[model samples]
Target chain A: MSNIPEELHYSRSHEWIRRNEDGTVTVGITDHAQDLLGDMVYVELPEPGQRLAAGDECMVVESVKAASDVYSPLSGEVVAVNDQLADTPELVNQDPYGEGWLFTLQPAEEGEPEELMGAESYRKLIESES
Target chain B: MTLKTALYEQHLSLGGRMVDFGGWQMPLHYGSQIEEHHSVRKSAGMFDVSHMMIVDLAGERVREFMRLLLANDVGAEPRPGKAIYSCMLNEQGGVIDDLIVYDRADDGFRMVVNAATRDKDLAWIDRHARSFGVDVQARVDLAMIAAQGPEARERVMRVLGAEAPAGTETLRPFQAAWNDRLFVSRTGYTGEDGFEIILPEEEATGLWQRLHRGGLTPSGLGARDTLRLEAGMNLYGADMDENCTPLESGLAWTVAWDPADREFIGRAPLETQRSIGVTRKLKGLVLEARGVLRSGQRVECGASGEGVITSGSFSPTLGKAIALARMPSAAEGSCRVEIRGKMVDARIVKPPFVRNGKSCLQGSPTDE
Candidate 1:
């Protein structure tokens, strides 16, 4: 479950992002966030057209034990939010990488994703923790 | 090294996050706490409560011994297999530990004590037993697993299969059985209807495996804490300890002062406290803020004074943070909890933030 593919980038705030072929990018929480949060029971996501600055709290993930703020890794407008998580939040705990992806974002800055951690660096960060 | 329960190996096998709770290595959760909680409410769940010490008392004057030992009167027309919940108090009427006293039979009684206070309880009982000729034996060879919730009994029945033998589903709440091998008691920490099964230590793993196979999810100490808190049950060490009396801890009703002449260990102190009037009280608080609440956080009462949260957690059922705090009884001060270094607005209310698998708040309708 911890196999963060080499294609994605991570933020210190625990947001994982993967750039799309278009100008948009996919964003979600990392496996680390889901593990600490026990079982995710509910999620409140920002709307598709919602505007956000970098590091803005645009979403929330509520686990059985605690509720956590999901900060935006990059300045962007939400293009699409995961509709499935509204009913099945366990996917975030089950498959944090695949079906659990939160939303797509059209970056306000073209190269903002470069500031985030790459797959290699993110793996090192998580490894250092344990 | 301290002795762990029979399920220690089983919990490890199931990939349970193990933590030392009251000296026993117990599971906090199998994998997901939310699913485990939901499983109990919607279906069935099992918890290894083997850390709690089970003491079997046998002597001619066992009934008489309990009358003076507990704050709750047990000499009042008691029958076999019936149980009474009591607070074992110190000389000053402060609770030493709250425990269940079961009348196993004539001249046979058993008391279950908290694991943290096991040594204290044994010493207290042994010191007091000399006057009444009581024999106290702590049952460390046995293990206890609680199968709790609406569907818990059926799951146990399914696991037992043909070995199920007799009627356990019909066992009324708080009743116990000393059948051929198993000692099943219709009691639980979760507010739901359930049974606590006690058997030999060797048989625990097999029974646990069977229960798991029958759809009873395994829950650890973490889920157990939330479940008990949601049900408004008190944690002995946190909610109330030797420093406070039961009367001030919202447990005044559990103390029986009837017959008046019946003197218990803490009778003098309790009576003195009653006459002096209680100063501080234990109350519940539901957080209305954005941050998470935790123990040791200051709860501001007014401009002058403050309280502290003894036990706090996010209520899975209500989807809000809740806690029990020790504060002054007289209050016109609308309370607020100090969360994340900020004094956040909070509502001080009664103990139960939720009950019977339903939310019990004003203006908020029950969810499911």
Candidate 2:
């Protein structure tokens, strides 16, 4: 099972978004996703300042054994991406909620992050999946 | 249709991600595949390899039969419990299977074959043994677990404690020993020092829990593939199957053509191929990519026409993508791989890209 922090909201695709005090939503994969994929070898991130549509593939994470895309949870303008993943991708597996965070974005429409699940809801989803 | 091993219940209890590999429901990983890969490379990890079929062949002529059946001759004098790695071949010189033959005693040799090829291998052996008068018994009651990596042996031995047998102390590579009903062999898949233990299926959970308590991480097949690739070990299905000859799969060293008079199923055709030289050969490719490399991806070796990657992955130790490719015989030096519709440049490199957690490939053509 993967770790899901209680303070964050999660998308069905296994990404977590932490609404920061600065109004940007910090995005990263859930500990569950990283655990399933194994040791990450390469991480491709979105270029900051780019506008993104909800559910768009904004990044890619490649484990030594498999590769998968990181989809955006909400429509927004990309504000930041952790460039450190280029050389230390395993951070995603080791610290999915902290230093392993993928990117940050500013909401474009000031709208709700609809369809996003809270920690309890995500846990239920994981339970139902089992 | 066969029954699951003893770890079946435990796998489900631990929330293992299961996949049907070669018709067996096996754990791909518990959660993080990358962590599992690193755990073995850096610490220790264990795998459930019970799906590999084990057959014990007992007969008076076991030695002579194996000398004729396998690519590597194990008929040479050997102490009891010594194991030999060999390949079974077809009459056309193509590989039937690669197997381990354990010279358990003068009375018999035990053959461990790939799970997917169990039926065909059994049929082949039975058909060819018509005159050998051997008793072939498939051992369904046993399960196999391989503890691998630098700390694998120590962790496993710690768990076994007094159960670790004397014969295993000075056990040479591929040697086996049985003590208190547990069989331990100095063999592994990770290209690291380790041991494989075969025991009653019911006892697997006990050992698994012990190893878990001892901190031997439970890794899945996903990590196994990457580890074997880094070790330059050929995967049976990907690198070569029943349709490909060992000669073309970079396993020619396993074939013994000694005495010049001994006859084997594939000898005639293999001899012919050797004389004319193989048309296609397996080679390693290190990609200096703008993206990832994967199997079934076509490789364009400039002027050598098309080739294809059989197995490929990002090498954790090297921090780059590597692949074992089947390419034209004349192919050499450099090549390009078609990834996501792009022709990404790559270079031919010697395999064993990493061994024992150290990088073996350097100066890879990353510039192009």
Candidate 3:
């Protein structure tokens, strides 16, 4: 079983979001996503200041087996991106939720983040898929 | 229901992530695939390969039958215990299967073939053997394990106990010796010193446990794949199939054209192909950019036309993306590979990218 923090918001695509009090949000793939992918070899992060829609594929995570696109959870302007992942993409597998956060985005609107699923729902979603 | 190998329960107990490979449920990895790959290169690892079908052939005219069946010259000399790797070809010059044949003289010969091609290979051999009065026996009752790496042989020896066959350690590469119930072969797909042991199915789990206890990391299909890929070995279905001939699949050397009189299946077509010249050739590709190359990716050769990647992966040893591609014979030097829509620079080189834990390509930084 993968860790699903109750405070985090998730997308059906498996991206997790933690909305900050300052109106910005930190986003990365959940543990479940990384676990399925296995030993990430490379990560292509979205550029800072780039704008994305609610479901745009903003990045790519590649393992030895295959490559997968990381979709955005909510529309926003990318305020920061994880620069360390370029040389050390294993962080996404090591600390997916903490130091491995892919990027932070300033939401286009406050209500758009709430449309994503809660932790309990996302846990059930993974269960149903399995 | 999918087929299960003798080690199915052992895989589950080891936390293997199972996936359907061909028709058998096999482990893709235990925990981390990269770690398992590194383990084999740096130390020792074991893989359950009982899924590969072993067939025994015995007859008075076995040698003559083999000369007619295989493209290689495995029948001319009766060198006991000599293993010859050859491609079983069809009358159309297509590769029926690739296998290892161990000559045990008039007693019989043993052949190990790919699992997926078991039924077809058997049918083909049976159909041809009828005239030679040969008996084809599939040894499904045996379980095989590949113990590979620098320390693989030592670890396996610890588990083989005193009953280990004489000349076990002295067995030359591509040779096999049997002692008691054990059949130990100094052959493996990984480019390392190791032994592939064939034993009774009932005793397999015990040997697996003992090897694991002796420090042989229980590797899965994932590491086996990367190891073989790094070694520049061919996968039966992916690298070549019944639709492709050995001449174009980087297996021309495995075909013996000597004597010029032995008429093996597909010999005429191969001769025609050799005379007419082969249009396509298999080449190795090294990505000069930061991206993972995968199978089915397209290789653009500009005016020479394009080719597809037969097998591609992130080489853990080279720490770069590498692939084997079937390109136009005229495709030479470097080419741009279309990886996920981007033209990435790649260099073509003779394969065996990593051999004996070292890079074989000249000018490669890893060569140092």
Q: Give a tens-digit lDDT track for model 2, residues A1-130.
A: 5577889999999999988888889999998787767778888789999899989988789876667988999899999999988877878888999999999999876755778989999989888876
Q: What global local distance difference test value does model 1 have?
A: 0.83
Candidate 3: residue pairs that collide: none
- Of the two candidates 2 and 3, the one with more favorable lDDT, higher being better, is 3
lDDT tens per residue, model 1, A1-130: 4777788889987789988999798988888878877877667778999998888988888776666889999998999999998777778888888899898999888685565988889888888876
TM-score of chain A of each: 0.92, 0.95, 0.96
Estimate the TM-score of every prediction.
0.82, 0.86, 0.97
Give lDDT: candidate 1, residue A78: 92
Per-residue lDDT tens digits for candidate 2, residues B194-214, read 889989888899988889889
Q: Which candidate is the best by lDDT?
A: 3
Q: Over 4 Å off in model 3, which ranges?
A: A112-115
Identify the leading candidate in terms of TM-score. Answer: 3
Residue-wise lDDT of candidate 3 within B1-368, one digit each (tens)? 69898899999999999988879999889989999988888889999998999999998888899999999888677888888899999998899999999998766789999988999999999999999999999999999999999889888888777878888878989988896699999999989889999999999999999999999999989889989999999999998998889999999999999879999999999999999999898889988778888889999988899998999998988988899999988998999899778888899888889988888777876743
Badly placed stretches (over 4 Å) of model 2 are A1-12, A16-26, A49-51, A74-77, A105-110, A113-126, B1-3, B9-17, B30-39, B42-44, B76-79, B151-166, B209-215, B288-291, B362-368
Clashing pairs in 2: A35-B31, A35-B32, A36-B31, A38-B33, A38-B34, A39-B34
lDDT of 1 by residue, B59-158 (tens): 8887888988998877666587888888998988889999988887765788888999999999999999988899999999999999998889887877
Supply DockQ values for each candidate: 0.32, 0.45, 0.84
Residue A43 Cα positional deviation in candidate 3, in Å, after optimal superposition:
1.5
Who is ahead in TM-score, 2 or 3?
3
Worst 10 residues of 3 chain B by lDDT: B359-368
